[model samples]
Target chain A: MPLPAPSPNPNPAPPDAGMSRRSFLRTSAVLTTGLAALAASLKPLLEMNDFPTMERFLQKYYKEMTPEDMEKVLKRIEAEVEKQYGIRPHVRDLKPMDGVEFVYCLNLTRCIGCRKCVHACVAENNQSRNPEIQYIRVLRLPHGSLDIEKAEHNYAPESVPEKGYFYMPVQCQQCKNPPCVKVCPIHATWQETDGITVIDYDWCIGCRYCEAACPYWARRFNFTKPSIPKERLNPDMAYLGNRPRRQGVMEKCHFCIQRTRVGRYPACLEVCPTGARKFGNILDPNSEVSYILKNKRVFIQLKEELGTSPRFFYYFDV
Target chain B: MLRLVLCTQPRSSLVAFGGSARMRPVEGDALTRAGDPMNSQTRTTLVLTGLILAFLALTTLFISNLPGRPLRQPPIPLVNTNFLDTATVRRSYADLVRAGEDLSDFDCYACHEKGKPPPLRYDTNQNLIVPKEHSDIVMGHGSHGRNNNCFNCHNETNLELLQTRDGHEVKFADSPSLCGSCHGPTYRDWEAGAHGRISGFWDRSLGAAERKACVNCHNPHSPHFPSRPPAPGPHPLRPVATASVEPGPNH
Candidate 1:
């Protein structure tokens, strides 16, 4: 090159000595290095998907949320679910009924292995359309045997009542010493003053601890998102009973706490054709249940060995 | 002289500048010699001082937060016997009478096992029909053995029977309390959410809805009573079979 440019002075003056090219290069280099380091450090944090935090921000627990907050949260949840599942879910608040109580009686003698209650419960509770997740199970057992291995529920319609077969509908026994309540780690489930056990859906961590402790096999977990369409959803919902549930929480029969406590009968009880299901206040003397107990004999319950002390009872004419 | 040049830079450099060089030795030489020991001693002292200060601070914090005195146990409320008094029991009996109910047939032992007639007479009135010896008849009821009796459930209510407006005799109270008499364990369980009906609802604000009673699910008299079947489902009609053993042989 034309007489190599005079060797530039190595030491550059400060910025105060008029803007210089050397100073420009030094400042730009420092700035570039700092930006690179910052971008590298922040990459991992920015990439992380905080759906749970987003969900919390979008919707708060019913207890923590005000009425206005709940309305906004409900709409947000409905929208979020629609985006995820391609279906909008209807969410409502289910409050406990006043004064009324619900009880269930199963006639082991008359049941003919008909699973009407199971289907009825699914429809009533708005459960997902999965065969394994039924609330009620009508067990087909031998007439004189109590062994669970001897029981079978896999019968075709024509195979029902084949010779000496009897039907036993096993549901949540609602034990006086409910083992499920004792095993919950987070206190997500508890007994109400009205003698019903309930679960807090949000507090549940999906650990499935209560599911193992229940003797009645009455509890069911939501493996996948529930699929009730927004338009078809039942607007009336209860905190402990038939509100739509999320994926991975333990739920069971509350004896229709929402219905019975409000002077209404449970769906299963209402549908039983033989009038086999009876519910009332054990406190009331004139109720029909009291009269029957006075008149009838030969009543029994399942698994008295575990000392669960279930509220449900069964009797036969003998 | 040749040796002297090498020696001059070495040995002579020290001696040539005697006092000034000696002063340098006093300054630089002594500092170099004592540097490691002084540094080590200072480090050890600093570490020990810090540890002691930290421990003292922690102990002071703990002691300052401790309670001044031991906690005292709470006082227990005195038990009242007014409800159990004989006079109160008489007044309750009078109230039952005013309700048009008879007082003679309402004793605890009357319908219970020890009574001449069990409190709830379904068929025949036999003394001690369900004998106290046969107390272990049901699940939760039998757990307390014979030590528990009707008063456990009847509580302070007078056992005197009363006649209803319809000219029917009945207990002063209702079933749950009446049954709760001897079955104290189950009664407590029921009161605290153990042995009773539990119903769920979908809608809560529609006023009143039809609900089942405890007796509807349980039979208090029998204890472990089974629920009856729903009204029977519709059955398929069957063809009539006619008797037709031809009279051909007779003709």
Candidate 2:
């Protein structure tokens, strides 16, 4: 433009300068590669994501967080969910009540293979509808056969009571010695005092160690970001229970902790058509579950083996 | 050409370094490439590391804050009820136990005053308790072809009350006692809260539970429980081979 800056020579090296074209080009290649490799390694730190990344990274383990910290974190989560789904969730860290160890009992004879409990659980728990995350899988077993493997989960027919079949709905056993809790690398999951196992959704790295550890196949992982419509979202939520989970988290039934911790019946028990399901505090001698355990021929899924000591009991009437 | 390029880089730097050992700018460039991961002092490396660290922090923040799409709830399917028939009863215990709650208050004499009643016997099918006068009252309970006489379970004297096997008068609400006379072990299990269904508070301290009586789940006319359509089965996650004749050893 002005004096026409001297054109920078594209190939500056000459054979007379005692430098080869190979040397000149080689230097350029190393510098470019070195810069790129460094950038590639930094991708994890540099990549953008949707969660409150910095805050999540520095978050303390659930057991270690103070009550004040918990309240603050809850507010932050509420804000995040609101921004994303347009529904402001009431997330609470509900504590277990005194002298209440919850127990569940199901009467196999009365169950008519109706899958109402399974659907009720899904709606109440904010379970992912697509890719269908169901917490309860009712096994339709042949008559006189207690083997769960022989049971068919996909036996939906034109009608039920297909002659020789008895139904047993399987869910998270809430085991006293839960293997899922022991296998969690991030301590994202643990047992509550009320005998319900719960997970901190934000803290789970989605490694799926807990899923493999569970004998009941009771856990589900969010492969993609959950897409709950704003209209149907259950705003009433317990932090460890049915709060809308984000992407890359593991979840399962928590016995409707959001409801049961407050002395309300679980959704599954409420929707049972045949009254096949029962739930109560084990400590209370007069509770229905205790009555079933004491008077009925109560059995567990894996009693002698696995030593999981499940709070769930399955029994057929005498 | 590729081999020449690969082989020449280090040699160029070496020769360039040797030729310009006293040159400050040339020495500075060499030091930077060597300084990374060794001494954390070079300005470019420090700046780049800081940028990388910040980028990571920003990345984590972005991911954690990304909007999660809310899942649309799958439309709940209404179960076909006509097929369910007698095999299932959706009503709770109190609702069923309260079947004929005002039995003591009801007077059957209002409809059937001291008049000549129709013949209590069916010609061939014992279950057809339908008197010609009450053609709408079609009884199907005699499906077993036995116990067709009206007075078999009912009291001849009282039209409003049921009679137990011991000839004792029983209220309609207390049908379990009459049913228990024949089903002894069933009654025992029912009393122990086993055979039928129980709903409401499990803790009696909270509220009294309602237990279903025998008649609540069975049609008295046709005692043989008819098969009905079940509630929708679980959504198949994969091809279920377990439905075959046998999948594993019987537990």
Candidate 3:
């Protein structure tokens, strides 16, 4: 039998050889539409390069990054901060030195209810100025009561230490078993070796689980974009610390990481009018925190039942 | 068409299967492995050489395009305005002692040592000694129903030195000790980092630690902790309605 010339089909499409042109056109049209849809969806993912959204999306957990990657990220952030705010930004990735565990103890007996610590903390930590994110809240408590719920945070008195009231400034307790760290959906926040619970602001998705989990009401949510005057912004900022934070992130006092890690008192302790605020390495035997802890009647804030084991202490001296 | 060779074929038979520049239809086994001119080793060598050349080129491009060496930034000068009022940070005793004003700038020997063998028997009750020169001295210290006089706290023998309750002479630099004699508990609290103002470095190893003297904060005349207007309080977007405590200007 004389065989017909082999069909032009490369494989088993021999049955549809007559309608090849129409079938090919239909297949091409479907592929083109599918690719177009994919490109449209991908456009959002690509166009966010201007806002660091792409970088944030691709960012691995902090510990996963290689040193070179970390260096590139830090440099990129430094350029961003410098460009956004008209000041040089020093974004440092500092390690907690060996044998240094930070602690802060405030003397309720000596706190004069002056909000100098609060203001100093805001300015030093690069907190938002207009909507006013303050890490320290000096609560005026009626004498003979330790009820924090009854303690007034916005109490503005004519004079401080109002005859029957004592002032207690509350900030992040920096718990050893931090509930804030525990509740984060992503590992954006973690407790440092030195007992500071630091948040990776860029890594944070602003889910606010950490904010809601805190017992002391320590964390502050950045609602709108933070507004800090360029002149007042502290250019010296740590990577996980007072580095000007973005909106939708959660922030609290990291015990002044930029200053404290380099062996300086926190801004609150530095500017405390009454010397009630004391911060130091608890591991160092001769630290002022050790002296205060040993000699005063010290106590912790809420979490008695929660058992967060906060490093921040409240002490009263007779 | 995919099987066609270009430029030139090898030399041999006209078919070129044996090496000659000619095209000829042949069976599947016509092109044997050995008919190829280049060996496996040569192919690998060429591939590796090309790969190495490509890698070197990429490395050179990357190295040349790297950011230039970092130049050290000369520190931008900052104004040293303090975070708060002078109440938060006063000139330390070390600062005052450096200026040689530890003696409270009182020229004491002019009146008390008027004789060859000055009997420094200045009576505490003699308040009218130098009314013109000492008028600014507020005697309001003893306003709490006690008729205390100058020599009560000032050493009569040496007017420059503070007198302690145990009749011990305390240099003005050692005023905390002198005050500790009377306000024992507060002095102990101050010593324990609880009472007084400690400015400057928390780690004493860093720099000269500044601890304010008892007299630095409290006026020795009044000796009461004077209350001042606190800094402006929290300015939340929604202003908090303060509870009905006696309203004052600090709010």
Q: How closely does chain A match the true chain A in each prediction, as TM-score?
A: 0.71, 0.84, 0.82
Q: Write the per-residue lDDT of candidate 2 for residues B1-251, one digit (tens) a residue.
A: 33332232332343332444245345455665575635623343354445455556655554454444344546644334332232235332335445645432245677665444434666654455566655644355554556666655666677666787689887766778877877798787678665665655555565666666676667554454445555566544444564474433322
Error of 2 at A106 (Å): 2.1
Candidate 2 lDDT, A1-318, residue by residue in tens: 479887763334444444445444444544545555566556555544564667766877888899998988889878877887788889998898889999988888778776777777877788776666789888888777677667678876776666677778888999999999999987899998989999988889999999999999889899766756566578888888898887789999999988887777788886675667888889988667778888788876554388999999888764
What docking grade does candidate 3 earn?
incorrect
Each candidate's DockQ score against the native complex? 0.02, 0.16, 0.16
- Give the TM-score of candidate 1 (chain A): 0.71
TM-score of chain B taken alone, candidate 2:
0.52
Model 3: runs farther than 4 Å from truth?
A: A1-50, A53-57, B1-94, B99-105, B109-147, B205-208, B245-251
Best by lDDT: 3
Q: Candidate 3's residue-wise lDDT over A180-226, tens digit each?
A: 99889888999999999999888898999998999888999987678
Writing each residue's lDDT as its tens digit, candidate 1 over A101-185 gives 3345565544545455665565567665421356777666655666666655554434344456667788887787789999989
Candidate 2 local distance difference test against the native: 0.70
lDDT of 3 by residue, B1-251 (tens): 11122112212122422233223324212433435645533443354445445545554444444444233334322223444443533443545777666645455776556333333222476443335556555555655425355666788667777788679998877888888888788888678666677666666666656667887666676665678677767755444677754322332
DockQ-based CAPRI category assigned to the predicted complex of candidate 1: incorrect
> In candidate 2 chain A, where is summed lDDT lowest over 10 consecutive residues?
A9-18
lDDT of each: 0.52, 0.70, 0.70
Off by over 4 Å in 2: A1-49, A53-60, A74-90, B1-5, B8-111, B114-118, B125-143, B150-156, B204-216, B223-228, B231-243, B246-251
